[model samples]
Target: MNIPNRKTGFFLVITGASFWGVGGTVAQKLFQEYAIDVNWLVTTRLLIAGLLLLTIQFFKKDRSQVLGVWKNWKVAMQLVIFGIFGMLAVQYTYMASINHGNAAVATLLQYLAPAMLIVYLLLRKQTMLTRLDVVTVSLALLGCFFLLTNGSLSQLSVPAPAIVWGILSAVALAFYTLYALPLLKQYDSLVIVGWAMVIGGFALSFIHQPWQVDITNLTVEASLYILFVIVFGTMIAFWFYIESLQSLSPKETSLLGSLEPLAAVLTTVFWLREPFGTIQWIGTACIIGMILILALNKSSSSKTSKSNKKPLRVS
Candidate 1:
């Protein structure tokens, strides 16, 4: 097992998010420039990445969790639903959004998941709305408005279909986050995520038929992109992010995850030469600020609660 180190944890999380951002940009390139089918790419990505992750979990990590997660039929059913509706939906919609729009836009739009999750919690009566919640939701909405409209009422920078898919992606992600909590608490993160992706890949294969995609033009460069998408983006990205949780609180990890959209935006603009407007930049800042506020608030509260405990266990 790896020893817990704050610096390593932070670095791993940053690297993971950076890989995801660059991978999304690469997927966008394949979609736009190569005429690759979205369904096939996503289906293959989920299956291959899931297998790679599970192989690692079974060999290098805990082998018990590989089988323990599927012992209960009730939980199994829930996992299936979570995999199909949550994981598959999020993946497909996100890629679809990128297909219709650009990586920077799609990634920033998916960052709306935090706001969507807040609302879902409210609806479930899981938590009451605080002042911070109000601010967070407002900032998300305002940021989205600026991003999509550039503060203009007349036109949208991205297509309407892309916006719809992007919003759907956020909704699916929110579901995936909340629904996977119970499983995550019981099983290893790697096990849960890997199996979920496997289930999702299997279900999506009916429509995508991964074998049907044309790979005649699969050059070395394209092969490298595919490898990165599956290896670095799907497998390593998730592994590093989850591993970081052992050393850092979820709030801190999420705060760092705010780097994802930033990375995507930078890569999209510079690497891919995608255009980003000034108002969109302002919108990005607002969303990132919201993430920071939440992280800071959670950290302060945690410190206060710990201090109030009176060091009862001290020798």
Candidate 2:
């Protein structure tokens, strides 16, 4: 098979990231209108997304490859983790954040995953903390504090539980990124994602008890919104993300992928007319700045290390 066009893949990555960002806004609308429980929304999203992608896999690729991976016990166990902790945890925590807080705030808090990853890496001794890392983390945390406080620290009126949920969501997202890296090395991207979604969906389904909900009574708009979550937000976006992983290094992919939260914030502001206070905007900018600094610092350090390793000609 021919390699995908890099430019095309990059474009798809950005598009997918943007869709992910905007997903909260879309979900928020459904939540308000249909009164859909967050758990049911998440379960339905994963099931529908999993089935749809499975169909695509059957048509576009060899089914045996996917089935073969599923049959592997070790890989299946990994998929279980991917589903439960990675997909399910991230989705549930994020939805909980949205339920407890507004979409914009929840979305911004979730973007703290990058900073969390840096901390996690440092803790694991996988990476060392440089001055730049410290400053970047500090900036990201300050931005988060601003968002939490809505810029007026004096008010400090944010709910404690909501803040905890937001932090949990960030942790889940960071773990998802870390866990996915190793799995991608060992499995076909789509197959790994498909099985993970299936497992995660079923797990969440049992937890959510979707059968208890009145599925037939859902209005057309609500039903369509759920379908949109399954189709555009989950299946298509995840497929593009996995495809991008095939082409880009993890750091490059993640750095470019920070566009998701920006997209979400913009979508909320423009489409929902969600109020964005000046303080909120400043916080958002700081968050983006921190991410940029981390990405650039990583890139520069990588380049310097490579240059230092070059062979010296004594002639």
Candidate 3:
């Protein structure tokens, strides 16, 4: 890759991840201040971003793939499964976590997906645990302990519901990362992700209609925040990150992706003034340390993971 392009890739990845982190905090503001429903926000974000992405793909080389993905019956079924379970589940659980707690905690909790994926691989005998993996897992557990409990085992710092939803979000993210590979290998990421979002949004509409949700408290500023979450957060963020992969290695992107949680934490604390305890900050460092270890050791990762070209698409 050209050096200039690599530099651009680093900038794009960081900007995209930062958008995601800030978007989460923005959503938290809407939820806390305006009492926006998580379901409605998820539904709206998916539909709009999905349509926008597909619109972009329509003018690109992968235009054919957009329609081609649904030509096969088995592929269609797989797409539906991925849309509802992978995309929808990940989005809903994450937003629910934010609604129940603050964005910093929720985002950090979701970062545990990589560790969860590693453990899943080990259980399947697809990958063996190394000393590094051991340290990674230990760090993840310890980090989560302090994050949720603030170094106190007897009491929880974050709400019970937030912790539950955040863990579920990680599970959903792991599933998304694992199952999305085959589709992404065959089709462009835009086509796969775009269609998945549309399918997920459509599926969710029957249960939670965005149009019916009360917007009486919606302000001009709130509308802009919502727009930012849908456009900058979902579409531009994913597009930029995917584009950056053309110039950067998966390992490099994974390492830099740490900025997402960092951005979320900083934005939540500084902008929203969410109170974070000292012990909780230590937990955040440990979690980030785990990500660094994982990325640095990517070369020694199992063949199964090496075949997987991308890292977890954390939001």
- Among the numbered candidates, top lDDT falls to 3
| RMSD versus native structure for model 2 | 7.0
Please, what are the lDDT tens digits per residue for candidate 2 over residues 70-157?
Answer: 6778877877888899878877888777776666777778778767777777777877777877877888888987776777757753
Lowest lDDT block of 10, candidate 1: 306-315
Model 1 deviation from the true structure expressed as Cα RMSD, one decimal place: 5.9
Clashes of 1: 0
Write down the lDDT of every candidate, Cα atoms only. 0.78, 0.71, 0.88
- Per-candidate TM-scores read 0.91, 0.85, 0.96
- Name the runs in model 3 displaced over 4 angstroms: 300-304, 308-314
**Ranking of all candidate structures by their lDDT, best first:** 3, 1, 2
TM-score of 1: 0.91
Find the 10 residues in a row with the least total lDDT in model 2.
306-315
Predicted candidate 3 versus true structure: per-residue lDDT over 95-153, tens digit per residue: 99999999999999998987898788889998778887788888999999989999787
Residue-level lDDT of model 1, residues 20-120, one tens digit each, is: 88888888988888777889889988898888878889997889889877899988888899889988988899999999998888887887877887777
Best model per TM-score: 3
Per-residue lDDT value at 56 in model 1: 83
